[model samples]
Target: METFTEASWYEKKENSIVKCTLCPHNCIIKPGKTGICLVRRNIEGILYAENYAVLSALHFDPVEKKPLYHFYPGQGVLSIGTFGCNLKCSFCQNSDISQNGIRDPERKALTDPQEIINEALDIKGNIGIAYTYNEPVIWFEYVRDVAKVAEKAGLKNVMVSNGFINETPGREMIEFTDAFNIDLKGFTEDFYKKHTSSSLEPVKETIKTIHKAGKHLEITNLVIPTLNDDPVVFEKMVEWIALETGENTVLHLSRYYPHFKVSLPPTEVKKLSGFYKIAKKYLKYVYLGNVADPAMGNNTLCPVCNSEVIVRNGYKTWTSGLDQQGKCKNCGLKIIEHI
Candidate 1:
């Protein structure tokens, strides 16, 4: 039988209704009903995390694949993800796992937190663990337990999330997390409401909290062709990021493709280029993804000398122009977060 662990960040209400405090949703779940995340359920009067120790996918991937360019440039991270997500995104690339409330027979596996930490130690060149693929925030209990153990063992912890988590849990998790790649879906609240079924404010809050906590932070904006490709809106988003997060914040403008629900044509390279140009206006570091533009976007250049500090081809990374201290070898400017 699948063990159901009582969840944290929830308050019992009248007649067995429980309010989930993990995210901005604050889903008031009744007895036998699950939260919007589909992973946290109210059994009688207690909130239980349904996906505890349940893994849908696990792999040793380049840290760069987390799209975290500024943190440990060429290191490997053992990425793990489980079922369910807090938000309902129409263009969700991993909806099969993210939306699967119950464990799928072929994809589900059960492993204890210590086992996961051991797997991280076994992988060659692995710097640590990355809670990724599906929304890691939905698998909060498992992630929190594994992260605590991983940190004690001196392994770094990274979170690749949509940044919808609430303040209390987010702060607690950030205490153990070393870095994050937050998905800033779009600029407008309407964009978030219409597409992701979540709000924009909470995500911004999550980003600010992580940044203020002194963790290495990166942001990714998936550019959907007609939905969120407006130049004015895109520029405003980049400007806000630069002002609020810092000019040095690493941002990735990713091309969108037809996925789970949205069937619009793939985002154009020209749109990405335009957004990239706008971002470069205020941000010190920005990159393009999904579409190939090797000379223009994939490689990282020093802000001071314009020398290629890190060369990236797909998941491959070469840190040739970065010194041991992670400074620009040519101009001696400190560019990345050095481990």
Candidate 2:
């Protein structure tokens, strides 16, 4: 399979340069240079997705491992990811793949989109495909192609992204992708600019855009110790999510560990508990991830009846409380739609 494909959402400029409009960065490439993503390159004024169909990792994982608590609780999904990321997050956990593009050609394979969909279909209990590990937004053309084939095969497409795409590209994602787990990062613009090398408003806009499209939207926020763990700021973020995306929106509060560049200590369990309390005030479905305590924030309860709707032990999930229609068996309150 060829690794290079003609890129979309770009404009030609004077003097053999191309401006990439796929994301907010709008990187201007000069001849042989690549964009901020280091994946899309401008070769003689023609933009091409240099990492198209080039996969770094592929696996079959539990849907909850996507940290999607509500989408398809107990089902598995075929996950795939390519290298390159639009943002330069200081503490990126997947920096080995995200920060670099197409390293070790012997390990990375260039697979076709239909082949990926075929693998997804062959998985025993797989519900669909998940574009994850690295930021899928940079792999826009490949993701669009794979999702087109997956949709026709009666499979779902889940995108675990940083939500940093431009409005036009984001709308295209909404059309092809079935569900999304967008990383909110933080609430303050200062935190976003300092750590992520991006802005916060665009991420918020992407979240709102997906929610307005009536898509299955979930938000994940990696709570760092000193940076974004302030109670007031965290509360504001939760309030905004509740107001804009509704209380039913699934929120995953993941504990941050020292990785990549940042050397800060792991988040305190007590601190995560406090934030969970604050988030519960506004959001109906809130979960704690990367913590040892399993019984704390892992289970889903009926919002109306206060009964256990879904019990999750690590990645093992059981929907014993919901009936065939995904309504609370105790009170008949609708908890999850697509179970």
Best by TM-score: 2
- For 204-251, candidate 2 gives per-residue lDDT tens digits of 999999999999999999999998888999999999999999999999
Model 1 over residues 1-339: C-alpha lDDT tens digits?
Answer: 246878988998999999999999999999989988888989888998888877788889999888888899888999988889999999998899887786663433545788888888998899999999899888888889999999999899999999999889999988989999999999899999999999999999999998888889999999998888889998888888988889999999888999999999999788788888899999999999888655569899998889999999888889999999989999999988654
Each prediction's RMSD over C-alphas, in Å, is: 1.5, 1.3
Off by over 4 Å in 2: 1-3, 105-110
Clashes of each: 0, 0
How much is the lDDT of residue 93 in candidate 2?
Answer: 95
lDDT of each: 0.88, 0.92
Q: Estimate each model's TM-score.
A: 0.97, 0.98
Output the TM-score of candidate 1: 0.97
Q: Give candidate 1 regions above 4 Å deviation.
A: 105-110, 293-295
